[model samples]
Target: MSEPLKSEIAREAEALGFDVVRFTSADAADGAGAALHAFLAEGRHGDMGWLAATADRREAPLALWPEARSVILLGLNYGPDGDPLSILGERSRGAISVYAQRADYHDVFKAKLKTLARLVQTLAEAEVKVFVDTAPVMEKPLAAKAGVGWQGKHTNLVSRDFGSWLFIGSIFTTAELPADAPEEDHCGGCSRCLDICPTRAFTAPYRIDARRCISYLTIEHKGHIAPEFREAMGNRIFGCDDCLAVCPWNKFAHAARKTTLSVREETNNPPLAELLSLDDAAFRARFRGTPVKRTGRDRFMRNVLIAAGNSGDVTLMPQIEGLLDDASPLVRAMAVWALSRLAPQRLRALRPFLAPAEADPAVRGEWLEAAA
Candidate 1:
């Protein structure tokens, strides 16, 4: 039987637009399984319980599928062309994560992975499966083991070539492909990602307390954002990128190949007024295929209202007026909270509309207190 030519397959993957390619023998990740277990036992995953439940399966690819003999880890670089931190000072605008500024990466990475896998199948005689954060398999450690990169202190894979801007995917197969030598830890003294967290989500050098993570708070957590995090959130309406942006390795980061990920002129720092005007339909139309879809309309508007409140721009009162009777009471309540932060005159002007409106009692109570 002819053995698979791993180097040839990796070249094909690079030609297919994958920035980095690597191969790892199954069970190579067993060494990192202990740290993963400790991470879960400490309840560091927050509400992402799937990470905990699938811990065993994730630590060992064989546990997920005994038929797999090899794992191919691929990294796609989506590094920003400019300093992502520059957007933070534009308080009038929403700051989107660099990864989210373009096409949905899952869609992009999966299609690329599939194309690469298909080419590999034509070259070899084994069955293959492709995944990009969609499976229980631990692609990070596997990528590190395969010499794609090292697991940064932030736990995301980082590379001298790609920085930490890589999006990882994998193709698991029954073929016995030769494995690449693993990369050693390069973050010996770097803690920039930890100190830069606005929410202080990092519990240690490498572990994150997802509950306080801004990405989790703005994108994942439902209901109201906890009061403590509201002020620190600034105007980041969708996700946080502080950890990724502050990494010194990003100096070597490459520019994105296409304008698709370029921040849209309107989206780059969307005026709080315009965002407040979006009803569910407008919100859906504006954000289709974007990562912002994860928040849904109501949650997104709630965040916008918080930003409006923080903007200290009393001129936004008119926009807040429209959302007072918004279909989502959560939005209306937040609107009231934001409006209250403005001049007493602005609050007085909104009293009649807010007083007669039959909104949620909790929200109404908040509105009434603001009126007082």
Candidate 2:
């Protein structure tokens, strides 16, 4: 496609609600692949074996799709209306990550990406593939190369105009477009993001140990969370945004403009008591269109139990008691921990009766640990 056509495509992207648009060659992501390989080699990704499984494809856009010559990166801003850190102190309520308070970004951005891709295909008569987060595309590096933003010390893409709140999407096209100048790193000497991690998930300036990340613990992890990180997790039931929220660049971010991306009132600071009460069906119904639903009720409740333990709200003791007999050992184990924190006497009183009946070794271990 011609340079003028690329400009027209950028205009169309903005019309489709994308905040930023840029282009880069498929080969631009080769350097980032080295970082991915290194991260995998150090076993920093934790249980997210998918990252290691798709390492080759994710290393470069060309490996994912050889037919593609150009990568069109698009960013949609989901900036919060108020200080995200404010909710962290509200221990009785769950502090969901801001981006997850709205409808799932995959659903919100997928249609828009396809629409833009179709337009590109029609105008340039080029083959196209669209991807949101599900695909194994290294979007942040490609986005940085495309001039959308620079990869900050937190390893997330940070833009001068959009700050750290952009949701990235990629469009791979057979037609080559002139690449935009890559954005220069603007995070010089700023360690705000690295220093703000509750779990010290950032091992260094740009490296993250996902095993300790609350977002990964609450959402991606399938089993019981390790004891060390549970208390540090606090009331963050869905995902953690400490690093992103602390970024100095967010001062320039505007509140989300798209209605679909706007935060749902019910999701903002939801009561931990209410969330802890959600059964499988209720959990699904409550978070239907939001990203929290993807974690499923078992894992979500496990997170809720951790928040409840840290909440210091003895009022949630009844809810914690109720979860002790839950079908999922993950939930039951965390519930035992929550009870021990909120009502140790009650936990001690019930240990004899509970421990004998619990068949699961993990749950029994939780009760045993709490009693000791």
Candidate 3:
């Protein structure tokens, strides 16, 4: 019963556009809880307090859904066609992460997961619960257990066929399907993922300190990014993908089957000048259905300002100066920093007017630092 049913489910999932389909028992993941606790204890998660908030449910499958006995893990590949790192040399452009260069995968995977979950319910007469990356589900560990891929040294799942580019989704079911053989780690002595980190985010082979990670600083960290990471950030205005792009296993990967998930031009390596010009409404309308919209205007502008400062294109001073008066201090502080870098004299001239009335202490401090 389990054999034929699992095969049928795999076919349907493939038909539904999932690149990889595999199964695992709904058992607790080996050491994910211990790792989570250690990560939280060290304050490595940064401002992502949600990781600690749902620590219990994130530890295991049955902990979240006790009625579950089997888990169906799905991998939807969104690998880029060309070198995702190629844009780094184009310092005047914003190098967005490959995954976020397209439409938001969370919405793309959720619609498909719901469709697949219904088929699983019919095939086994079982109760099913679906989860995407958003939930408390420990997706990478469970994906490894289900034979989708091994957890790479950089702590993301690395598929033999998809490299580190698979977006994981899961269906936890009550049906007793046999688990697939788990994949063993193939990282060997390669430290490309670890070495490629501009901010030295990897504490060890498999652990990451997110607070120092560029991905965290640019996207996750709400406050002003630290001075140390500002230059290392280069022109990556959104998430960083250096580790994933350098992997040797990407040779086997192909471009995504879904065109909607491919790297769209506007979000992929677009010019810093253009991005710096975006107002709140313009930012929303431009990135409407994409992942960039979720980061919202103020934070996104802060990142763009960092890119502008690093660009060495003094032409962006006007736009940087404009943001110095932005409503969000998150934007104004970074603008002050960027202005000092691109046009120190201009920033010094404006400091007299800007610093006195500044209500936000952080922005005022940026003004003082610019003077000193």
Candidate 4:
């Protein structure tokens, strides 16, 4: 395709609500394999073992589909107006990742990617495929290569236009397109993102240990949360966005123009009491079209129980009390821990549930320890 055609496609992408669009030859992403190897060698990927396997393929986009000649990186800004991190101190409420505080980005981003790809195909001749986070595409590195943003020290892509709140998507195609100049890194001498991590998930500049990342634990880890990090999780019921929220660059971010991505009143700061009471069906209904539904009720509640333990509100004891008989042993176990942190009167009220729980040896031990 001619350079003019590429420019027109970019203009159309912007019109479709994408903040930035740039092109790169699929063969240009050669450094991805080595960086991924080093990242995996340190076990920094945590339980996300998929990254280790896709290292080679992710390194070069052409490897995924040899027929693809160009990759179009798309970025959408989802920046919030206020400090998303400030809500962390409100222990009685839940802190959701800023991106997740509105509509789910996957659905929003994928629809936009599809629209852009269709428009590109109509203007130029080529086979096109759309990918958001659903594919093995290394969006941050590719976005940097495409001039959409630079990957900051926190390892998330940050752009001058969208700050650190942009959602990345990509279109791999058979058309030859003019590529954009790559953006320069601007995170000079700034360690705010690294120092702000609750679990110190960053091992060094630009690398995050997914295992230690609260986002990974609360949303992706299916089993019981590792005991050591439970207390540090605070009341974040869904994904944690502390690192992204603390970035100084967000000051220039524009509020999401689309109301769909704007913060919903109920989601911006949900009451902890209300969130904990959601049964499976209610959880699904309430979180419909939202990212929290991805974690399912069990995993989400596991996070909630950890938060309840940290709440220091004896008034929540009754809600925590009812969870003792929850079918999932993980939920029951967390209830016992939350009970242990309750004030004396509330703890006394929990004794009846603890006494019957003795048949489950694990529950018995927790009950004995909390009662003592």
* Candidate 2: Cα lDDT at 171: 93
Per-residue lDDT tens digits of candidate 1, residues 36-72? 7887888766777788888888878888888988888
Compute the lDDT of residue 50 as modeled in candidate 4: 81
What are the root-mean-square deviations of the candidates from the true structure over C-alphas? 2.5, 0.9, 1.1, 2.2
- The residue ranges of model 4 lying beyond 4 angstroms of the native Cα positions read 28-30, 344-372
lDDT of 4 at 45: 74
**Candidates' TM-scores?**
0.91, 0.98, 0.98, 0.93
Q: What is the C-alpha lDDT of each candidate?
A: 0.80, 0.92, 0.90, 0.83
- Name the TM-score of candidate 4: 0.93
Per-residue lDDT of candidate 3, residues 1-372 (tens digit): 379999999999989888999999999778987898999999999999999999888989888999999999998899888888989989889989888888889999999999999999999999999999889999999999889999999999999988988999999999999899999999999999999999999989999999999888887888888889999999999999999989999988888879768777778778888888888899998888788888889999999998888888898888888888889999999999998888899988998788899999999888999999
What's the residue-level lDDT of 226 in candidate 1?
66
Whichever of 1 and 4 has more lDDT, that candidate is 4
In the range 1-372, model 2's lDDT, one tens digit per residue, is 489989999999999989899999988464798999999999988889999999999999989998899999999999988999898899999999999999999999999999999999998889999999889999999999989999999999999998989999999999989999999999999999998899999998889999889999998988889999999999999999999999999989989989989788768879998998899999999998999889999999999899999999999999899988899999999999999999999999888777799999889889989988
Backbone clashes (count) for model 3: 0
